[model samples]
Target: MRLSELSVGDHGVISDITGLPPEQRKRLVALGLLPNTPVQLIRRAPLGDPIQIRLRGGDLAIQKRIANCVEVCLK
Candidate 1:
């Protein structure tokens, strides 16, 4: 499933990131959104455009479009 589809409090390991521009992909990786990393959906904006997530000991808010490119395997 895509990260964007995860429900709040869901936990998963990142499987892949695809369908994104190279720069965006690298930025996400730099922010610790890498394959095999554990992540949880923390919350979402009122309109759901930006979603908050917990990963690598920190929380990040990313656009739904970017989250849609991130694949995850639920734990």
Candidate 2:
């Protein structure tokens, strides 16, 4: 499943992020969102343009388009 599909409070492990460009992938990795990393859905903006997630003990907000490219295994 994609990160964008996860609901608030849901947790998952990233499986792949090949759908994103190199720069985007690097940015995500810098935020500790690499493949195999655990991620928790925190919340989303009212319009859903950006979604908040917890990783590496902090919150990271990503756009919906980027979230769609992150494949994950739900927990």
Candidate 3:
């Protein structure tokens, strides 16, 4: 499933990242979002645009559009 489709409190491992602009993909990878990494959905904005997630012991808020490019396997 796509990371953007994960509900709050869901946990998963990243499987792939596709369709992102090179810069954004690189930034995410640098932030520990690489494939095989564990991830959890922490929260979402009131309007559900930017979603908060935890990975590699850190928290990050990412846009849903960017999240769509992230494929994950439920954990």
Candidate with top lDDT is 1
| lDDT of each residue in 1-75, candidate 1, tens digit only | 999999999999999999999999999999999999999999999999899999989999999999999999999
Residue-level lDDT tens digits of model 2 in 1-75: 999999999999999886788998998888788888899999999998799999888988999999999999997
Candidate 1 matches the true fold with a TM-score of 0.98
- Provide the RMSD of all predictions against the true structure, rounded to 1 decimal: 0.4, 0.9, 0.6
The pairs that clash in candidate 1 are none
For model 3, how does the per-residue alpha-carbon lDDT over 1-75 read when each residue is reduced to its tens digit? 999999999999999999988999999999899999999999999999999999989899999999999999999
Give the 10-residue window scoring lowest on summed lDDT in candidate 2. 27-36
Per-model CA lDDT versus the true structure? 0.97, 0.91, 0.96
By TM-score: ranked, best first: 1, 3, 2
Tell me the TM-score of each prediction against the true structure. 0.98, 0.93, 0.97
- Say which prediction, candidate 1 or candidate 2, comes out ahead on TM-score: 1
